[model samples]
Target: MTEVFFYHLQSQPLEAALPTLVERSLERGWRAVVQMSSPERLSALDAHFWTFRDDSFLPHAPASEKGAADQPVLLTTDEQNLNGAAIRFLIDGALLPADSANYQRIVLMFDGNDDDAAAAARDQWKVAKAAGHTVTYWQQDPAGRWQQKA
Candidate 1:
């Protein structure tokens, strides 16, 4: 069964938090696909990855790249897993893919400050749970550390 994790962004923006998660996924030897809802968001994320930090950057490519499947982390606006990834990250109001179980894990990150985003996450949580996926919820602390809430 796929494990679905809901990350409620409160303390920091997605750009600040996402790189760490992607790095952690790479550490676990898991390829990751980050799905967004628009090309503009995808492009921004692609550029952000290259300079998210002063010293290092996550190795990634857009799904439209020539060797997208060879990238360790792929960014796109589509639900298709171009890379053979073990994890899929849904962000920027991206809906849960119909083939949610295709990946080992599905991470749904939503802005807690956004009423619509929070509401959407709740709906996704219910759907994932109903589908028999192990679901977990996480919220950030004041210091920007994630704490599992459910």
Candidate 2:
């Protein structure tokens, strides 16, 4: 069964947190696809990944780029998993795809400060649970560390 994780962003924004998660995914030898709600967000992330850190940048490419399947991390605004990733990261209000379970893990990150985002995460949580996936929820603490809440 797929393992679903819900990350509620409170102290840190998605931009501040995503790179670490993607890096960890890569360290685990897992390819990841980050699904965004819009092309603009995907574009922003594409640039951010290059300069997110002062010393190192995450190795990734947009799904439209050549050899997308060869990228360790793929950025996109579509439901298709062009990279055959082991994990999928859904952010910026991207809806969970019908074939979410196709991946080994599904990460749903939402802004905890936004009511709509929180509500959407709740709905997704219910759906994931109902679908029989192992679901867990994590919330950022005051210091920006994630603490499992449920």
Candidate 3:
């Protein structure tokens, strides 16, 4: 069974939150596929990853990039895990994979302040639970720390 994690972003935006989470996934020696809501977002995230930190080098590239399967992180606009990633980072309310078993963990990050995003997360959480996946919700506390709420 795939472990589904809902990260409700309240204190940080996607640009501010994604890099660290992706980095952690890499630290654990797990490849990651990050799918954004739109192609525009995918391009933006590709640039964001390059410049997120001056000294940090996140081994990532766009899905269309050459030799993408060799990268530790791959950015795309769909559920296809180009890099054989065990972790899937779905940002901007992207849809979950129909067969989530392909991933060891699926992290859905949605903005808490966005009404549509919040509703989508809630709906997905219910669907994931009904499907027998282990679903956990983590909300950001006032201090910007993640606290598991459900």
Candidate 4:
């Protein structure tokens, strides 16, 4: 079984929140794979990870790139866990199939400002719950701290 988490982005964009969560995953000794809704987002995401912070960088590679197996973080457009990732991040309204047993956790990060993303998150919430996974919803408070809503 997988623990499915939904992160509703309001104050900060997904780009900012994703790396923070990925850092936590790395600290927990977990390899992470970020699945975008399409392949076109790969280059931009790769760049963003490298320069998201002036003093930090999240080491990552595209799934099709070389040395992916050695990367702690991977950006991809598919469900292939080539990097042996225990945690997976679903972004840009990407759909994760019902079979999530391969991963310990699956995170759905959607921008509440984007109508498509918000709608997608709602659809996925139903899918994940119907699939019998432990579903949880998290959102940032006024102070920009994470709080579990449901």
The residue pairs in collision within model 1 are: none
Write model 2 residue lDDT over 17-55, tens digit each, in one string: 999999999999999999998988989999999999999
Clashing pairs in 2: none
Q: Give the alpha carbon lDDT tens digit for every residue of 1-150 in model 3.
A: 999999999998878788999999999999999988798888888888889999986889888888998999999887778789999998887888886888899999999888999999999989889889999999888878889998
Candidate of highest lDDT: 1
The alpha-carbon lDDT assigned to residue 14 of candidate 4 equals 78
List of clashing residue pairs for candidate 4: none
lDDT tens digits, residues 1-150, model 4? 899999998888777788899999999999999999777788899999999999999989998888897899989887878889999999987887545878999999998888988888999999998888899999988666789999
lDDT of 3: 0.89
Of candidates 4 and 1, the better by TM-score? 1
> 3 or 4, which is superior by TM-score?
3
Residue 144 Cα positional deviation in candidate 3, in Å, after optimal superposition: 1.6
Which whole-number lDDT from 0 to 100 does residue 30 have in model 3?
99
TM-score rank order = 1, 2, 3, 4
Cα RMSDs of all predictions? 0.7, 0.8, 1.0, 1.2
Candidate 2's C-alpha lDDT? Answer: 0.92
